[model samples]
Target: MAELANCPRCHALFVKGPAIVCNDCVKREEEDFQLVYSFVRKKENRTAAILDIVRETGVEEYKIREFVKSKRLHPAQFPALSYGCERCGAEIREGRLCESCTVSIRSGVQKQGELDDLEARNKKEGLGPVTYYTVNDDNR
Candidate 1:
């Protein structure tokens, strides 16, 4: 017999079964995995975008995406399997990008945050859109 210590996470004595982790840690991890799996499996939740999961589960977007990518064994088998972008929340079909995101990517690279970005930044900073005066002295 070897030494038996209570798991720090679950506070349960270690066992040599399906898990090297203590039962409590395993249960906690299993619960987290289930939450992630459910979020990925459901259609509405699937399209819920990236930050949604971050907000809901407090897991980082990149880590969540990695989990989705690595956990999926068969690619074609899971046609609907996808993750969302923190920017748009649209389903990333593969390589973590949807069609619109692909286009936006090309366009954003061209502008490099010259347009529309100002508005996003303003919003981020808690400032509403600024009304501009046109050449004709009219509000734009």
Candidate 2:
């Protein structure tokens, strides 16, 4: 069943199903996509960067980035097309984050897992009472 909701772009009420925006916003988005697609498909504009395309076509940078992120624009054909990392503002052609951010996040998770394992081991070993030991200086 479709739920009634307000369109994100124009704040108009519409049935929300597969699309978040209303029909009008969808049509506008389609037009923008066509404009961007047509511009990028031209032989002379094939090598143009996202900024160049935006400047030439008067399209918003975020719109172009969205196209690239959604796979609407082929990164191989448009080598300069890239999006900012979600964690860091680094240029990346694929995925939500750059390689460095990915590694950092993975390392952090590994460290957390190791800490949890250590805590589990300590608990399993019975963390009950504390004991202290003393050595007599005369023994030396």
Candidate 3:
């Protein structure tokens, strides 16, 4: 069901549906997409990077990135069209993080798990920090 909300792009009140923007903004975005598409569809421009496409089409970088993310622009067809990894800002065609960052994060998580396991073992074995206790037998 559509809900009433303000459009993010034009600040117009619109019934929010599948699209987050208003109808006017959606039309404008379609125009921008066409411009960007025409520029990149050419054989020579197939190897053009995202910045190059943005410069030629006068479209914003984020919009181009969105196109790539949505698979509206296939990076396989246009070798240079790519968005940044969410972690290290390296250019990537799919997923949030690039290969190296993913590996690094995975390694970090594994190490953390190892540390946690060791700590748990130490705790279970009563091998934690030393404590002193004094004997008091006066009451007895």
Candidate 4:
């Protein structure tokens, strides 16, 4: 079932289906993709970076990045094509984050798990919050 919604790109009302944007925007994007694909398919432009492709093809950087993210443009064939990490703005060929950010997040999760285990052990052992008292010389 298609629902009426405004297109994200052109703000035109259209039936929403598998695509997020309206038909007009989709057509425009297809044209842009063709322009970019033609430029990158060239032997001399095979090694061109995203900026170079944008400059030569007159295509938006985000559009090219979107193609790379969607796997329409493969980085294996064009080594210079890549997208930024979701967490950090580091250039990455695949996945949401770069290797460094993934490792850091994994390490943090492991450390949190260890802390939770230790807390559970302390609770099971009947250990509550620690209390400290200072002696009063007058009372002593």
* Backbone collision tally, model 1: 1
Candidate 4: the clashing residue pairs are: none
lDDT of all predictions, in order shown?
A: 0.65, 0.89, 0.91, 0.94
Model 4 segments more than 4 A misplaced: 129-140
Top lDDT hit: 4
Each prediction's number of clashing residue pairs: 1, 0, 0, 0
Report each candidate's C-alpha RMSD, comma-separated, in the order given.
Answer: 13.7, 5.7, 7.5, 4.2
In order of appearance, the predictions have TM-scores of 0.36, 0.87, 0.80, 0.89
Worst 10 residues of 1 by lDDT: 72-81
Candidate 3's displacement at residue 83, Å, is 0.9
**Candidate 1 collision pairs:** 49-89
Best by TM-score: 4
- Tens digits of per-residue lDDT, candidate 2, 24-135, equal 9889888888998999898888889988998888889998999999989979998878988999989989999999999999999999999888778878898744468999
For model 1, residues 13-61, the per-residue Cα lDDT tens digits are 7755545668776666667667766765666665555567668876556
Cα lDDT tens digits, model 3, 68-129, are 98899998898888888998999899989999999999999999999899889889998994
Off by over 4 Å in 2: 128-140
* Candidate order (TM-score): 4, 2, 3, 1
Tell how far residue 71 is off in model 1, in angstroms: 1.5
Clashing pairs in 3: none
